[model samples]
Target: MKNRSNQQKKSDRSTSQGTSNIALMALSAVPLLMVLGNSMLIPEFPKIKSALDINQFQVGLLITLFSTAAGLSIPILGFLSDKYGRKIIIVPSVLVYGLGGIISGLGATLLDDSYLIILIGRVVQGIGAAGTAPIVMAMVGDLYKSNDRSEAMGVIEAANGIGKVISPVLGSAVALISWRALFFSYAILAIPISLGVFFLTQEPTHQGQKEKLSSYLKKILQIFREKGPSLLISLFAGMAVLFILFGVLSHVSDILEKEYNLKGLTKGLIIAIPILFMSSFSYLTGRYLKQKGKFFKIAIITGLTIVGSALFFLPFLKKPYIYVGILTIMGLGSGFVLTSVNTLVTSSTTSEQRAG
Candidate 1:
């Protein structure tokens, strides 16, 4: 009788853990979807500018505003999630993100000042998104054993690649009908996505060890004092340089059209070549990291590729095939760097600190 009861208890524990992991996976998907919506907007920039009667710079500002808001809010929301619980932050954040999309859609349809309204909506969306990506990653840190955590992180990273893959094509198609419809379509997805997260994912229980704000601040300060400076420096330097490279790449479709006289889908295909290379390399790097445990080496290779590609672009900017080759090298480099960074960040932090 005792043996049977012990077996039953073990089985119950295993079942509970399985359910928790499934929830974590679902929660992870939300951020991937959010990123998809964000990336998809990139290709639709021209259409949006045309529809709203805005200039290229103004359209660029929209992208800037969204990223800036999200980046600034991440630590704040991360702190809140640590204090309260994951679900408390996540559920509300998802709804707010969806609301932003809806508001942006409505503004695009109803208002003459659509660009202004869209900007406001993106800010709101960023606020919510700030919580989604990091928190989901933090939750994966919370739920899994240390050895399994990398695989979980890899899965999330893969989902992100999948989002990037589908977003441009899907976003472009919707924008074709009406750019406003793109926002509305994303908003609709958000509603169902949020509901899924709420119902499926459990809020991890806080272990009754709440710290005072002063202590929390002190600890956070200490974390930075010890580790923050280097990580911040690396993150900022890497992200800034890469952002400029991506900005140049973003104009490739236009370059092809203006300089090479390619049009329509052909122009898009030329632009997509880099993303395709990026996605393929991302998948391969994630798999290799899982198997080889050589993240630092891979990252170095990626960095060298980026520098080489940039140098090559200086000389061969006019040749279409050469541009593609250089960009592909850049894409491969980016994939390795991103995968390694994410793995390192997740691996280096403890659960409590990761929640921050």
Candidate 2:
């Protein structure tokens, strides 16, 4: 009888773990898709500018507008998710994102003057993006406990890194067919991911639904007051790392094509090098942090130092191998910093206020 009980318990544990893996995978897709909304378009930017007869500044607005929209909407979406549920908000948001992509593709393909239409579509996609990766981070916090949450956070960051590595190459390849095709690809890819997230993941119970909005706001404010310094610093580190990574990538893409005569898939493959390093380091750092939570401050400091050193040396290194080597080091630093920040931010709060 004891043996039978033990066997059943073991079986249940295995089943539960398997289910958790599936759910994590589904959640990871949200960040990957959200990333694709922007990074995948980087390689296509010059082509887009020329096709639409727009200036560099005008073309740049595509990314700026999307980012601005997503940034503005995130807090509101987080509040809604806290009130209702993560999955409910996520499902419709993904659908909206895909719809936005479709509109952009149609306008670009069928219209003579389509820049305005495309910009509108990008705004819509950005709003959808606001509900994606951030909510997934909060949901993961709600679902897991202790080291498991940290590990899951790492996995999510790694997924975002992987998306970055993939986007450039994928964008260039698709652009070989038609740049408009890239827009439609967003919709094509989002559908399955959205469905997977809806069905595969389960949200843990949240107390925010019963709490008054005013009380919830007060609680969040209190959390900020208590952890304000550390949280702000962590947030800043995350923002700086991402800004550097993306800014470097955009510049590299342009120069690789203009100066090095490396365009299309060749340019993209080169762009992927730094991102690949970043992704690998992110996965490793996440695992390490899970095991050694006490080293959070050290990891953050070390990452920042490495990134700073790399940037300082960048101006003098014009040789291809040397330049790429520096970028690779920077990528490693970014991966470490971002994984630590993400884990810290998500695990700091309780389920009730996590999404908010």
Candidate 3:
């Protein structure tokens, strides 16, 4: 009888472990999908600009509007996720994201002057994006503890880096079918991912009374009070690296096309080199930082210094390969910076206060 009981307990533990691994994969998809929403459209910018008969600055608004809407909506969506549950916010938001994509694709294909319609659809997509990757960060915190939390956050960042690595190539390839096809792909992709998040991942059950808004606010404030400077620095570092990364990618795409006369897959392959370095480094960084809480500050500083040095030399280089080499160095720095920042922020507070 005792042997049977022990066997049963072992079986349960194995089952639980398997479920957790599946859940982690679904969660990782959240960031990757969110990245595809924007990054996948980047390589098509010139084609889009020409199609819509818009200037560079005007065409740029598509990305700008999406980001702006997402930024503005994130806090509201975060609060809702805190109240309702991460999956609830994520599932519907993903559907909305898909819907927005369909709308944009239709407008681009069917309308004569569809620029405004496309912009509107991007705004909708942005709102959906707001509830995705950011909530996944908090969701991971809710689901894991201690060293697992660090490792999971690292995987999340790595997924994000991987998305960056693939998006340019994916975008270029899809645009071959038709640039409008790119917008429609979002809907197709979101359905399975949302279903996975809804079904495969389980949200941790919160026991006891839900905190009132006042109490929640106070707890959040206290966390900031204790870790305000470090938190702020981490936030800034994360944002700065992404800004540098996307800005470099946009510029590089244009340079490849106009200067080198490279287009489509060749251009995309070149663009992906740096991002591949970033993703590879991000995974390695995450593994190294596991349970080593003391090294967060040092990692951030080292990563930023590497990025700064690379950026300094970038303008002086006239050769495409060398320029790409410098960006690869930058990507390496970004991988370290982002993984460290993600782990630090997620681990800084309890799940209850994470969204706040």
Each model's C-alpha lDDT? 0.71, 0.86, 0.86
Off by over 4 Å in 2: 1-25, 53-60, 137-158, 199-208, 226-229, 295-298, 343-352
* lDDT comparing candidate 2 with the true structure: 0.86
Give a tens-digit lDDT track for model 1, residues 121-142: 8898888888787777777777
* TM-score of candidate 2 relative to the true fold: 0.81
Model 3: runs farther than 4 Å from truth? 1-3, 144-155, 207-237, 283-309, 312-316, 339-352
Q: Residue 155 error for model 2, in Å?
A: 5.2
**Displacement of the residue 75 alpha carbon in candidate 2, Å:** 2.6
User: Model 3, residue 311: displacement in angstroms?
Assistant: 4.0
**For every candidate, C-alpha RMSD to the true structure in Å:** 3.9, 3.6, 3.4
TM per model?
0.81, 0.81, 0.83
Best by TM-score: 3
